[model samples]
Target: MADLVTPAERRRLYTLLSPAYLWLMVAVFLPLSAMLFFSFLTDMPQDAPDWGVTLGNYAEFLSNPTYGTLMAKSLKLAVTVTLFCILIGYPCALVLAKSIKGRAREALFLMVILPFWSNSLVRIFSWAIVLRGNGVLERAINWVLPFDVRLNLMFTTDAVVIGLVHSYLPYVILTSYLALQAVDDDLIDAARSMGASKLTILRRILLPLSLPGLLAGAVLVFVPVVGSFMEPRILGGRMGTYYGTVIEDQFVAVYNWPLGAALSFILLAVVIVILAAASPVLKRAQT
Candidate 1:
């Protein structure tokens, strides 16, 4: 009976999976192929057909010192935000993971995630409002603190960093908490019984064990933050422009679709290199 149904069952399973396979090819593969193809093409004006397949776009991006500087600035901001997220979020996650019970923990987690549900544009605007010179925090600070110290929070790189950290903090918290939750309570008790200092236990046991999750969270937050256009657009104001803006201007303002695509793939390449570098570090940490 089993033998008779096995082949039929396998055929049925394959039939069910066929749609998903087709979807993956259509949705993922096709777009990636198009992007790869366009990335090699030269920019064309609206009146012109095309500038033909060439390395000019890539060459321009790489050769220009200004573009390189923008890339470096974006990377620096991302690193700063990622570090801030780790430092602030890890402790919050630990507290949530260790002591908070079921419903309350769920509520707190929901609260943490709630901001992310809002549109990214909306979130940025909200922050912009708050960080404005006469905004709530600024007004409160002025009212409470000493004379004439008006904080110029908006339109600076610091504002962009703060926005990135705020937006992605939940990812770090969730990952770190999940990692912390996986550690055995019995082992922790054993370490305490052996008179291990709290700091020593955390440094030797907890940090090493949680490295995977920390790395995972870092990658999650850092990658998206580095390429993010909206936060920089709103919070960056005049002074703190990132690489995304340059790519955006090429495509939208300059009508250089080919060059925009090329810039995007360049960004993709850089991100891939970063991930490739991290892969070995992640593997080593996990082991």
Candidate 2:
């Protein structure tokens, strides 16, 4: 492909892409480079006269078990939220893609993405209001059921999961819907003509074909949710103290930029490793 492209065409293409590349360099790489540099420092150069490069920040991570515990908690929360999003969002995507049609589908798609319309803080606080003791959810449940139920979900891990899932579910649905939509309806009809059950078709055909999109959505949800502090903080309260919150505290409350940079770099490395490990599966799905 490189050989086939003429020099002028290649130059034109690069020219067209230069702005985006420049933006990435400035917006993403510059900060990351600064953070990587800071990660090895004993103190910010601006703050301390004797500041020097040191491995102590990273060493602390190895020495301290609390970071590991919090990291595990965040990873668990991410996996739980991703799984819930898949289980809920995939079915919704399937229905929108294969069952519904016309304006109804458009309306339903709008509803699926409705969460994005609101500010994230507003959404989290709204959930906080609903999940609190004797809040809307508890009241609704009590009203529907004959027995009295005292349901207080706020400040729990479950509340964090719920908020995260609600926030990220649209990613899964949109990706899955696009994938599902691309499947030729004729293929499904042919399978039906051959006496294939809906379950069989979904398992052997749709699921395999849409695996990439599902994985894309999972990655989208997992990456952000793992690093999430806001939703967890607002919803989980005391229970929300995960690795991300620790990182936030290091940068904000503790004002330990070096340590924070080290922690952030470590997280970036972990996420890179995870994505690298999953690349083969994604490639297989693509094939």
Candidate 3:
């Protein structure tokens, strides 16, 4: 097939792909190269008279325990959020794909996906409104119960988790739903005919079959959550000083561009390693 294309066909193919390839080079490759170049420098060279390339930026991360601790915290948060999303979203997807039919399913799916249409920042801020003390949640709880309630989740880890989950839950549902749609009903019916319990069928058949999609969604959720800054800042307040926030601070507040660039590269390396680790499992699940 590679050799079958004439010169004109190859030219047309390259012509069709050129714009996207060029855009990728400009948008992604160039910025990464610039960041890598800056990461070795002792300081940002724009105004400084004595700027030179050094390994101190990388050394900062290696020598200091604080950054490592914060990075571990970020990883923990990402894992927690990804698990919660999987637990919550996969069920919604199963119900949507296996149980519902026609227009109702379509409507519910649209409702599920409606959040993706809205601004994420706006959504996170709205959660702040709901999670804060004396907000609608407190009022509603107070209304439901006889006791007086004053809820204040503001500036808490729980609040941050909630915000992050709300932002990313739809991704898992979408991916899992797509995977479930490909599952044949006959397989399930056959399992039923063999007197298999519901749990057994789900564990043995559905889970293994859908693992690839679920893992894909989880990776999507995990990668961004690890690098998240906004939700923590708004919802976590004083308690929100995670690795990403520190990276932001290094660049924006501290003006330690070299350190920031080094941290960013380190983060990139972490993500790449994670994806490399996960790829084999995902491929196996697909098979």
TM-score of 3: 0.95
Clashing residue pairs, backbone N/CA/C < 3 A, model 1: none
Which lDDT tens digits does candidate 3 get at residues 77-192?
A: 99999999999999999999999999999899889988899998899889888889988788889999999987788889999999999889999999998898789999999999
Model 1 Cα lDDT, one tens digit per residue, 103-130: 9999999988987798988888899998
lDDT of 2 by residue, 1-287 (tens): 46747888888889989999999999999999999999999999999999998999999999999998999899999999999999999999999999999999999999998999999999999999899999999999999999999877999999999999999999999999999999999999999999999999999999999989999999999999988999888999999999899999989999999999999888888889999998998899997
Q: For each candidate, give its TM-score against the true structure.
A: 0.90, 0.97, 0.95
For model 1 the TM-score comes to 0.90
Q: What is the lDDT of residue 134 in candidate 2?
A: 92
Model 1: residues with Cα > 4 Å off, grouped in runs: 1-17, 43-47
Please state every model's RMSD to the true fold in angstroms: 3.3, 1.1, 1.6
Best by lDDT: 2
Candidate lDDT values, in order: 0.85, 0.94, 0.91
